[model samples]
Every structure is written in structure tokens, then in C-alpha cells.
Target: MDYFIIVITSAAGLYFHWWLYVRIKRWMDRDLALSLAGADADKRALMLQRLGEAQASGIKRGDLPAWLARAAGEYAPPRD
Candidate 1:
């Protein structure tokens, strides 16, 4: 039926998308990119500290408000 076809297609789409993400993530990890961004030692260390604090704050990413959620989209580049 239509629903069954949709489910299968959606699953296939998600699998392929995740596969691509994993491949590219291994190619260039986020933290490594951040470290290589030409920042000085003090700035880099401070940023890393803030990143750790953010992680420790336990604010789930999904819980971000809509405005902030859209801002997060800037982290990833558009797919080629």
C-alpha cells in the first residue's frame, strides 16, 4: 500500500543520509576542525572550556527554542 511504500522509501533515505554523514565525519571531525581554526592558545583553551561547560549543563540540543535551533543549522555546510 501507499503507507508501506512511503515507510520503506523514508527508511532508505534516512539510511543513505546517515551513511554519508558517517563517511564525512570520519574525513573531518568537528573538534579537530575547531582546533585548527587559527585561534591562539588562550582563546582555544577558553573555547574548549566553554564547550565542556555547555556539555555539562545538560541542556539537550533538541530542547533549544526555534530561533536558536535555526542558528544551529549554520554549523553544517550545505551538501555538494
Candidate 2:
């Protein structure tokens, strides 16, 4: 009985963590994409080239930009 309770709670915790990760990752992607869209053409092109090289070197696509942005500074959460 104790084992069953423990397993259930553990599963719940894992699910919550996964859900939270997905939400935050999605937000980061959207934020970075919007920022890039607003950037001037030359700057945007340079950034995209860097992102492509990073992807070729084994970094996952669509992630480097957001990671770089976050490392640079924290962003405000999107309003609902």
C-alpha cells in the first residue's frame, strides 16, 4: 500500500515537470522568434547563419537562439 502511494506521487511529479518544461520551452521559442522578426535584415541573417552552424555541429535546431537570449538576460513573461 505504501509502495503504491509512493509510485503514484512520483508519477504525478514527473508529469508535472514535463508539462512545465514544455510550456516554458514553447514560450522561449515564441519570444525569440518574435524578436528576430523585428530585427533588421542583416542582423537577422547573421544570427540565422550562426544558428545553422550550431545545428550542424550537433546543437538541436530552434534552441540555440533562445538559449543565447536567456543567457544574455531574462525576459518578461508574456501576458495572457
Best by TM-score: 2
lDDT (C-alpha) at residue 80 in model 1? 58
lDDT of 2 by residue, 1-80 (tens): 99999999999999999999999975665456447545555544544554455546766645677654553343333356
Model 1 Cα displacement at 75 (Å)?
Answer: 32
Candidate 2 steric clashes: 0
Which stretch of 10 consecutive residues in model 1 shows the poorest summed lDDT?
A: 64-73
Provide C-alpha RMSD values for all models, in order. 12.1, 10.3
lDDT string, candidate 1, 1-48, tens digits = 999999999999999999998888534433633454335554445444
TM-score of each: 0.36, 0.49
C-alpha lDDT of all candidate models, in order: 0.52, 0.61
Q: Where does candidate 2 stray beyond 4 Å? A: 39-59, 62-80
